[model samples]
Target: MKKCRASSRILLIGAGVSGIAAATRLLQNKFGNVQILEAEKRIGGRINTIPFGDNVIDMGAQWCHGEQRNCVYEMVKDLDLLDFTGDFFSGVRMVRSNKEVIPLELGQQLYGIADMSVPKGSNAEAESVGSHLAEHYWQEIESQLPQVDRALATEALECFSRHESSILASDNLFEVSGRLHLEYEKCSGDQLLNWRDKGYARFLRLLMKVCEDEPEELGALEGCVLLGKKVVKIEFIDPDKVRVVCEDGDAFDVDHVICTVSLGVLQEQHERMFSPPLPAEKVNAIRSLQLGTVDKMFLEYEKQPFPDDFVGFFCLWREEDLKQLRCSDFAWLEGISGIHKIKHQPRLLLVWIGGPHGRRVELLSDKRVLEGLQWLFCTFLRFDVPPPQNFFRSKWFANPNFRGSYSYRTTRADELDTGPSDLASPVMGGDGYPRLLFAGEATSQSHFSTVHGATEAGFREADRLIKYYESCKTNR
Candidate 1:
């Protein structure tokens, strides 16, 4: 009664935190065969850090993001990555209307806005950050900082706009649920989320360490991690076997496949790449998910022109500038708001935006980005923080593999089922077994905008697959 077990491989796509997390589990559990395939030349997806000036510059996912048992934090701690101490709430110096600088403390009047919620009530369901902030903010703030006294009101609205729109500007904050909005709103709320000294990019290195611990099974193989190899198509030959083809005309056979690509990539590029086509449910998840872009227009200053007491500053724009950046072609991001800081000693500025503002930046010209920066400095400092002698900003969406930065949403917050594991929850075969899977931050909707979400999503999927495979072994 001796029967042989058929051996098959598992294919993992994308090399971001999620991909690495899944791979770590596969190798750790001694899974017979698990390989990761990355479309880009580098393994790390969004965690990019480089030596800018004398300090390390984080191009993506710098914050630990909403603390509380995050996988990224755990992994980094295991690796002995360094952490720094700063006043999460106090180190902020805010820029306001009438070109005045202030602190971020919640004013008594602002507290009313804080407690205020949707028209239905504070406990209402579904709305966007913009609409929510606009609705409650004006009610409480205007009485205190009247429109006749435009400076404080303008600055308060600008700060709120900067915070709210930075996620998903297109989100109808008004329609969003009160509970979910307050939850995320508090996470990234006015209080600071401390900066890291070890740098977020090091977490990727630690994952690489885990994956490299054993080379025999899942190590970087010829068939796995095909750089310059854009994954174009995937076909499930049958339930127990799936085949993946690359743009360069390469094909792979695996027992099952996991897709960890960005939401934006899945949105526009999914149909062209996957074979037999992903079902409407999966496709809908992709379309429904929002991929936010938090671009940093970094500039290095030679002197301490701005205040030195804080690490950064937020800016407001002229009504005209706001109108200008809003043009579909202009993206009106510069008009909405921005952040300013320094590279260690020399001053620096990062005019950031997410949601509608972010997509608008992509449409803007470099001259426009530069102009936006200038506007930020002029508005806040009232003194032009001269254009950086050196500067750089991210264009993550343009990349075919990453269509944009990590995913998050204002309107979609109430939905908890969108976590990245859903992507990997076994696309069913005819007999009800699994076929293809999905895992990524976009899937990790609640934790969408950070490094930990991706890693946790990856680990969750890997464990699931290992359990699935173990069950198969037991059945035989």
Candidate 2:
């Protein structure tokens, strides 16, 4: 393991999972004078937890996805945080546009067919998932299947499209690259696990606690985190030194700096955020990756309106209707993939809106959002209910700090043959050493769009710097 010079200064940008993880790891490695600049007043970055009534709700990252081998999952287990299994597509009530409920069995069958359409073999990367599935259905149209079955199949595909798109937080299926969609590295086990009791913020706090060398050491590390330091520009003084200037006029000079900002932020601010501009290749790579949005609406009521056993509902739009209505219209509810009933809080309902529509919802007034939700529920349930007593919605896309919620594999960047690797590479200084390094979820090839991915990237860069300093000391 490489150990950095005790006197070398390190500046970490963004106190998100990656920045926090990097800073803690560097401290443990005996690197001193490490400073963190956070745009938000709080730590955890995208992992935000807010007080709601008697319980805590996670406005940002809510799950430790994957199973046993998952880095974040393992950490959750190590901390002994209480978690509950999340069943994907479970207890979903698929309602038709005509106000009819599709048979659960038929919905499941169509979903299975859609899943089977995804090529498991080598050709998987050669085409997009949407294209592949569309071809399958087109072939089915010519097959011996009854007209009724074919119509059902089409509806099922539409339902699947809405559901999966929301899960991917993608605008459309055709925009996703085939290889990029299915070939991501996976850790074995369940796909989802919710932090039931304390929410995900506990994990961030726990990481800070565990990274301390001694009881007093934690205080020193905590003191290093500077909140509300919105970085406006990074000026490279030389190959070995860089200066970070904040919006508030504060400046930080350090030996090495790691930027763990979101891809969306990079896209919006990269041209102005760096001195002498970024390399064309880096700029191209940044522009190539597509950032997506997934906004959450938490509806809390004073009374329960649905059955106690009902966990979630999926409103399936008629294929013909969906086709006629352009996605650009920004009919927010049409983009709602599902509504999940909070297990612990029966009065709470979580609605997921994704793609461009998700951002549209952010522009709406609270009353407007509630009215939209009321219409969706009344139309699908064939009944009316009282307005929610309280509600909360996420605005990750609109936030200048985030710009968008997550990253996705896109068709745009294939021309340059660049992906996360290009984005992750360090900007080399004139002295032949890495000066500005990048670390974030979007930069992780296998785990892009995941908290664990960001955390791992931060640790990876920190280790690199540590090793470089250790090598230097040995040579001397």
Which predicted model would earn the best TM-score?
Answer: 2
**What is every candidate's alpha-carbon RMSD to the true fold?**
4.9, 3.4
For candidate 2, lDDT tens digit of each residue in 140-210?
A: 54453345456666677777787777766679878777767555677766666677767877667767874
What TM-score does each of the candidates earn?
Answer: 0.81, 0.92
User: What's model 2's overall lDDT?
Assistant: 0.78
Report lDDT (CA) for all predictions: 0.60, 0.78
lDDT of 2 at 5: 64
Off by over 4 Å in 2: 1-4, 86-89, 119-121, 137-149, 210-220, 319-330, 472-476
True-structure lDDT of candidate 1: 0.60
Distance from true position, residue 67, model 2, in Å?
2.1
Candidate 1 Cα outliers beyond 4 Å, as residue runs: 1-6, 78-85, 88-91, 94-98, 102-126, 142-151, 167-179, 182-197, 210-224, 318-336, 342-347, 363-368, 409-424, 430-432, 471-476
Backbone clash count for every predicted candidate, in the order shown: 21, 2
lDDT of 1 by residue, 1-476 (tens): 21112254778888777887787677666665667778887766887777675577777766665435655555554544544334432444555534765545543234235335233345444455446666766666656545334554565455555555454333334433343443332233222233444456556656655343443233423244655667888887765678889888889887777788888788788788777777765665666556755666666768655656555665544566556546734355443444656333255566676655666676677787777566655655655566667777777766678877865543443464343334445687765555677788766645655666677778877777666666454323
